[model samples]
Target: MAKVIMTCGNLCSGKSTYAEKLGKELRAVVLSIDELMTTVLGRELGDMHDEYVRRCEQYLYKKAAETALAGTDVIIDWGFWKKAQRGYAREFFRQQGIDCEFHYIAVSNEEWERRIAARNAEVLNGRSDVYHIDSGLLEKFRTMFEEPDRQEMDMWIE
Candidate 1:
């Protein structure tokens, strides 16, 4: 049986939403790296530097591996931004004969701007402590985001 499903997308791209939906559909455990990074690192991952991000990502991946090895289905919600990240994840799942699918959540710039505006408003209102996306930040991320293709992902939604 398949044990791994990687949900890939940039920030504010609805990856978490679709991951939750897929988790419900598959009855799998959705391992949100964002949540882990926020809780464990005591800060939103978006605020972390590359080295810190890599460390946090490693911990998340290790946990996912453990969860899947325990026979629980795992859905990871993250950008999986670089090929190295996806390659490592794919190899780990392949070695275990665990099924893997990638869902690339896609959204328009308008949607992303809307989401960021709403989120930033929440931050300003004291509803959140971190992860405030300014007006141009979403555009910045979109610019840098590299979509995962067939070579890195077997399937995509969006």
Candidate 2:
């Protein structure tokens, strides 16, 4: 049976890197909202960012269900930042009879900050398609991101 591997983490937490590794191990397709959004919108959505992200996520979830039903494993590299989002994803897959695993990429604040700096440098150099986390955005994300408790995660990677 196919399984959906959902990644849960905050920004710059290495979800995409882990997703790529896991996808190779499971021989599955890795879908990333950041990759999709950056490809289509060139990494800047401005005021409509949240709305666009929601739309993109909905589309990806539909694609994931279809792919899982087809017997192919999938790794979704979205920052499932809230408990409600995690619950919704699990229930959605359960309703479709697809197995779902939640993997939380736990990163220390120091490490996360380091990664953000590195990523921002890459973005500045045009070496990556990811958006740079400025101070305001970082603070906003910190306030908005919901850290998952141990009970909510199937596996934790640090």
lDDT agreement with native, every candidate: 0.76, 0.93
Question: Which 10-residue window of candidate 1 scores lowest in summed lDDT?
Answer: 42-51
Candidate 1 local lDDT, 2-30, one digit each (tens): 47789877787788889899899988888
After the best TM-score superposition of candidate 2, give how far the Cα of residue 70 lies from its true spot, in angstroms: 0.4
Across 63-85, the per-residue lDDT of candidate 2 in tens digits comes to 99999999999999999998999
TM-score of 2: 0.96
The alpha-carbon lDDT assigned to residue 72 of candidate 1 equals 80
Output the lDDT of residue 71, model 2: 92
Could you tell me the TM-score of candidate 1? 0.82
TM-score against truth, every candidate: 0.82, 0.96
